[model samples]
Target chain A: MDSANERTAEEVAWIHRIGQGDKAALQLLYQRYASRIFRFVIRMIKDEAKAEELVNDVMMEIWKSAASFEGRSSPSTWILGIARFRTLNAVRGKKLDTVELSQAPEAVDEGEDASTGKSQEQLRALMRQSIARLSDEHREVVELTFFHDCSYKEIAEILQCPENTVKTRMYHAKAKLKPWLKNMGLAEAELGGVT
Target chain B: MTEQRMDELLAWYANGTLDEAERQEVEAWLENNPDAQLQLAEYEFMQQSVAELGDDEPVFNTEAGLDNLMTRIETEEAANEAVGQQSTSTMLERLQNWLDETLNWNRTPAFARVAMVSQFGLVLALGVVLLLPSETNEGYEVLSGTTPAVIAAGPTATIGFNVDTRLVELQQLLREQQVVIVGGPSAIGTYQIELPKDDLVEARLAALKAHPAVIYLQRNEP
Candidate 1:
C-alpha cells in the first residue's frame, strides 16, 4: 500500500486500540492530529486558548466514541469532521465574529513597501491575510481544499454538505481571493510569473 | 468539460485531489486554454499560502493537552465504573425481589420446606466450623421462631409501617381505611393488606401513602 493508505491503516488500528481503552493508542492518535485540529479550530474561532481546549475536547470525544467508528470515511476526514463541528458550535455558542475579507486589516509584513516591487514572501503574506479574511464558509472551503488537502467529496463530508455545494463554495472563494491577489500586483499574467 | 466546470474544480486540481477522469478533463482544458493555466497557478499559490498560514503561529502545547485529556478519561472511566457497580447492586436487588415474589417458600409443602431448611442449616454449620476461628465460637442464632403462613386471598397490597407508630394507631388506621392485615411485618416490617375490590385501588393506595403511619407501599398483584 501507498504511504497515505498505510498511514490511514495505522490510524484505524489506533482507533481500534483506543476503543479497547488503550491510553497509549489514544496518545499516539493525539500526537498525530492534535496540532492539525488545533490549527483548524484556531483559524475558525480565532481564539488560541479555546482552540486548545476544543482540541482536547475532540480527542476526548474520539476516546469515548472510537468503538462506534464504522470506517465509512478516511480517519482524517472523520477527525476533521469532528473538529469542524466543534469549531462551528463554539463559534455559534460564543457569538464570536468571523473576519470578513472586506473588513480584514491591511497586510503589514515587515519591510513591505509599496514603492518597491513585491517579493514572493510579501505576496505570500498578502495571500495569507486575504485567506484569513474570507467569509467563514468560503475560508473553510479554501482551507479544506488547500491546507487540509481534502478533495471536494471529502470537503463535503467534513462540511456535511453536497459535493456540488463544496465546488460552488470553492469557486466563490477563489473569486473573492483573485481580487486580493490582483491588488497585490498579481494579475492574470503575473500569476504565472510568480516563481 | 465546460470552462465553468473546470473553474469549479481548479482548487481540487491544484491540491492534487481530483480523481483520474476529473484530473484529465481539467488538464485537457488547461492545455487548450492559457487563461486556465494562470487560474490554476493562482490556486496553487493560494493552496501553498493557506497551508503555510500556521508557520508563524506559536506551536500548541500538545503534551499539556494530552495530559488533560488523559485526566478526563480517567475521571470518566471512574464514573462509569461507579455507575456500573450501582446498576449491578440495583439489578441484584430487583432480582432478589423477583425471586422473593416468584418462589414464595411459604407456598411449598411443609415437609419439603423443612427438608430444605435442614439441609441449608447443615451446610451453614459445616461452613461455620470450617471457616470460623477457634476462639470465635459464637453459634448461629435463629432470628425468627416461625415463618408466617402464605396469604391466598384476593388482590392485596404490601406496606411498611413507621417503627414509632403505635399499635393502637395502626389498628385504628386499618379500621378506618377498611384494609385487613393478611400477612407480614415479614423480615423487613412490610405487611400484606387486602383492599376492597369495590374501591379504586389507586385511590386507596394514594390515601395509604399520605398517612403518617405508612412509610412505604406497593401493589402485590399476582
Candidate 2:
C-alpha cells in the first residue's frame, strides 16, 4: 500500500482496538493527532477554550464511534472532519458565522505596515493580518491547503465542499490577500505566483 | 479551458495539488501569458504568507480533559450495565407499581379490595358454570311463589287393556323414574310433591294425569 493507505490501515487497527474498549489505544491515538487537531480546531474556532473543548469532544466521539469507522478516508482526514463540524457547532453556539464575522466592519485586521525598511517578522505579521481579513470559508481553505498541506481533494473532504469549489475559494482568497501583501512592500518578483 | 479555469488550475498547480498532466497544461498556458504568470506569482506570495502564519497551541490540560471524558464514559456505561443487571423480579415490581399508580388501586381500603376481588371471582365462576353443559338446562327455573305443588288421586282405575302387558309396561316405566311425595293429604285432599323438580317433572305429571286413578294433577311450583 502507499503511505496514505498504510497510515489508514494503522489507524484502523488502532480504532478496532478502541472498539474493544482499549483506553491505552485511545491514548495512543490521542497522542498521535491531538496537537494537530487542536491546531486545526483553534484556527477555526478562534477561541482557545472552545477549541480545547472541541478537541475533547472530537476524541470522545472517536472512542465511542470507532467501530463505525469505515476507512473511506484517512484517519487524520476523518478526525479533522469531525473537528470541523464540532467547531462549526461551537461557532453557531456563540451566535457567529465566519461569514458574518469576516463581514463585520470592526473585525477587519488591516496590518498597516510602516513605510520603511521592515524586518521579516513585521512582514510576516502583516501577512497574518491579511489572512485575518479573508472570509471564514476562504480562510479555512487557505489553512487546510498551506498550513496543513492538504490537497484540494482532502481540503474538499474536510470542508465538505467540491474540489472545484475549494479551488475557486482559494482563487478568491488570493484575490483578497494580494493587495494586503502588496501594501507590505513585497514586489511581485519576490512573492512568486499566487498561492 | 477558459482563462478563469487556467487561473484555477494555476492555483492548484502552485499548491502542488494538480496532477502532472494538469500541471503541464497550466505550464503550457503560462508560457505565452506573462500576465497569468504575474497573477500566479501573487498567488504564490499569498500561499507562502498564509503557510508561515504561526499556529499557537492552546493552553489546555489534556490530562484533566481526558480524565473527565473517561469518567463520563465510565459512568454512562455503568448506568447502562446497572439497568441491564436488574433482576426480573425488580422489573415485575416496577410494573406492578406502575399499574397501581395508574389505576389508583393502592388507595382502596383493604377489606373493600378483598371484597371486590371475591365478588369478581364469584361472578367469573358463576358465568363459567352457566356456560357448562349439564343434565338441566341453564336458566330453567324462575319460581313465582314458595308454595309446594299438589297432586290429587282418583277414586279407582277403569281401563280396557291386555292387563298383564299393560301392568308390566307401566311398572317398567315407573321403575325408570324416581318420584317422592313430600306431604300427606291435608284438608284439601291433595298430596305435595318435592322431588324431580325439573323439565322431566312436567312429562311425569302428564303421564299421571292421563291415568284413570289420577283424578286431577297440577304443578303449582317448579
Candidate 3:
C-alpha cells in the first residue's frame, strides 16, 4: 500500500488505543501531527486560541471516538475530517464563510517562518487576496487536497464527489489561480512559456 | 494521445489521478513536449497558491487549549457530576423529605442526602455518570401536562426523522407524502386518516372539529 495509507493504519491503531484512555496513544498521535493539525486549523479558524481549542477538540474527539473507529478509512483522514468539522463549527459561530491562512494561529518560528511575521505582511496580504478570489468550494478543495496533502480519492471521499470530478475541479481551480499568481510577481520567466 | 486527449489527461495528471496506462501516456507526452512539463510545474505552484489560502497554520497549542478547555470541561463535568450527584441527593432528599413528609415533621439536613444515597452508592454514582442526560427543552408540552424530557428515540427513528424532515424542508412537507384525509373538523388541521378503523384516531378526529384545522397523522401502529 501507499506510505500514507500505511501511516494511516498506524494512526488507526494508536487511536484505537487512545480510545481506551491511553494518554500515551494520544500523546503519540499528538506528536505525529499536532503541528500540522494546528497549522491547518489556524488557517481555517484564524484565531490562535480558537484554533488551538479546535486542535484539542479534534484530538479529544479522536480519543473519545477511537474505540468505535472501524478503520473504514485512513486515520489521518479521519482526524483531519474532525479538524474540518470543528473548524467549520468555529467559523460558523464566527459568522464567516472562508478563513484566511495568512493569520497564523500563534507565534511562528521567529526566524524561519518570517512570512508569518511583519515583513512579509504584504506578501501574506497578497497571498490571502489571491486566495480569497476563489469560490468557497474551490478554496475548500484546494485546502484539503494540496495544503493538507489529501489525495484526490481522499478529497472525493471527503467532499462527497466522484474522484474524476475532483480532478476536474482541481484542474479548473488551478487554471483560475494561474493568472492571479502570474500577476502577483510571477512573470513569463516563472511560467517559462517564453523563458 | 491526441492534443485534446492530452489536455483532458493533464487534469488527471496534475492530481495524479490518471491510471497506470494514462500516467505512462502522460510520461511520453511530457518527454516529447517540454512545454507540458512547464505547464505542470506552473499548475503545481498555482495549486499551492490556492492551497495557501487554507495553509494558514496558526500554531495551535493543544496543550494550552486543553488546559483552558479542561477548566470549562471540568466545570461542566463537575456541574454534571453535581447534577448527577443531586439526583441521588434529591432521591435521598426526597426519601428524607418523604420520611419528613409522611411523619409530617421537618426537612432533613444536607448531610442526610449523602448518607441515604450511600446504600446505592456505586450504582447510583455510575448511573449518575453514564446517564447524565443532555439538556432537554424545558418547554411545557401542554399535552403531556409537564416539562417533557426529550427521550432519544431509536437511532433508526432519528435518522428517518431527519431525512423526512429534510425532505419536508426541501419540499414544504408535502412532496413524497401521500396524505389520505379521513375526516377532521372544519377548524384545526386536516387529519391524515391512517387507520382504516382506529377508534382512538377517529375520536381524535371528532374532537378536533371545533376549529378550522388540518390534522394529518398515520394511525397504523403495527
Candidate 4:
C-alpha cells in the first residue's frame, strides 16, 4: 500500500504536467495505465482483440484531452473509472457470444519453471482459465483483489459496491473453485497448503 | 460451532473486514474448534489462492490493451466533441438572440461581422518564406532588368544600374511600384544608370519594403 501510494504521487506529477499541456507527460501517463485499463476492459469484455483496440482509443483520447482533466480524482482513479465506464458500455452493447474466453490466447506466458523443467506457465494458464469461468461479477471481484492487488475497500470503491458485497463475491469465487482444485489431484498439502 | 456461523466469519476474515473485537472472538473460537480450524484454512486458502494468482498486470497483453484503449477513446472523444460543438453553437445562438432583441444589428454586414469576430481577438499572421539569392536562377535576370524608382512614377519609370553594388543602392531608392534595370558596368566599377523624375518622392519607402540590402534602384535626379 505504501508503494502504491508512492506510485500514485509520481503519477500525479505526470498528471500535473499533462494539465499544463505537456504531450510527453500525457504519453507517459498513457503508458503507465494502459495495462491496468486493458486488464479491466478485457476482463469485462473477455475479447482480447476488441479490448486491445479500445485500449488504444483510451490512449489517444488521453493525448487529445489531457487538459480536460481537472484532478477531480487522482489520475489513476480517474483513468480506471473511465476504463470502467467504457467497459460497461461496451459490454452492454456486445452480444454474450462475442466474449468467447477460449478463443483469446494466454495474456502472459509466465514460462515453464523457474529452477527446473517445472512449468509455472501451465499452472498460471490453468489459474487464468479457472478465473475466466466465474461469473462476470465474480471474476471482477477476483480480478480487483488478486491481479490489481487492490484492497477490499478499493475494490468496493471501484465497483461501487458495498464493502460486504465485495467480500461476498470473493467468497463465492473461492467456493466455485473448490471442485476444480479437487480434480487437479492437489489438496491443501500439494499446492503449498494453498497459502 | 455451526458451519454456517463459521462460514460467515471466515468470509469476513478472508476479506480482512472484521473489526478487532470480532477478530479476537473468531481467533479465540478457532483455537479449539477443529471444524473452525478447517474453515479458517478455507478462508486463508481463498485469500492466498487469489493473491498467488499474481496477475501483477492483468491487462499485460500489449495488443489487447491498446485495442481496449482505442475503443474507449473513440466513444469519449465523440461525446466530448459533440458537447463542444453544442456549446459553441449555443453561445452563438444566444448572442444572436440578444443582438436581435436588444441592439441595432441592422448595421452593415461588414461592420457587424467584424465587431462580432473581433471580440474573439484571435489574430492570424502569415509570412512569406524568402529564398537565398544563390538558390535562385532568376537572381541574374533581376540583376539585369530595370525597375521604376517610386510609386509616383505611375507604376513604370526608369531606374537602372550596371554593377551589383550599384544595384543594391538603386534598390534602396525605389518603391514597390518602381522598377530598376542594369545596363552593365562601367570602367570605374560603377553602373551607368537612369532614374525617372516622376517617382522621386516615394522611391525610398518602396525600397525598404523590397529588401534594399539585396537590390538597388537608382535615385531620381534631385
* Best model number under lDDT: 1
Residue B70 in model 3: lDDT: 49
Instruction: Write the residue-wise lDDT of candidate 2 on B96-154 in tens digits.
Output: 79859875668988897798779989999999999876542221111322233334231
Q: TM-score for model 1?
A: 0.64
**lDDT by residue for model 4 (B94-170), tens:** 98888767765656487776876675454321122232223322112222344222223222222333335464454
- Candidate 4 residue lDDT tens string, A1-195: 667568878887887786676756766777677777777776677567777666775666566666777765566656766677667767677653434556534433333322134354544455566677777788887776655656566666677889778767877776776554444334444433222
- Model 1, A1-195: lDDT tens digits are 978779999999999999998999999999999988987887776567888999998998898899999899999899999998887888889886555556575654433433157777767877888778778899888888887888999989999999999999888888876666556654565555432
Query: DockQ order of candidates, best first?
Result: 1, 2, 3, 4
Deviation from native of the Cα of residue B179 in model 1, angstroms = 34
Q: What TM value does model 3 have?
A: 0.56
Model 4 error, position B141 (Å) = 84
Q: Find the 10 residues in a row with the least total lDDT in model 3 chain B.
A: B152-161
Can you tell me which runs of candidate 1 are displaced by over 4 Å? Answer: A100-103, A107-116, A188-195, B54-58, B83-222
Candidate 3 ranges beyond 4 A from true positions:
A45-48, A97-129, A181-195, B1-22, B47-57, B66-86, B104-222
- What TM-score would candidate 2 get against the native? 0.59
Which TM-score values does chain B get in all models?
0.39, 0.34, 0.34, 0.30
Query: Model 4 in CAPRI terms: which quality?
Result: incorrect
Winner on DockQ between 3 and 4 is 3
Of 2 and 4, the candidate ahead on DockQ is 2
TM-score of each: 0.64, 0.59, 0.56, 0.47
DockQ of each: 0.47, 0.22, 0.16, 0.11
Candidate 4 chain B: 10-residue stretch with minimal lDDT: B133-142
Clashes per prediction?
A: 0, 13, 20, 42
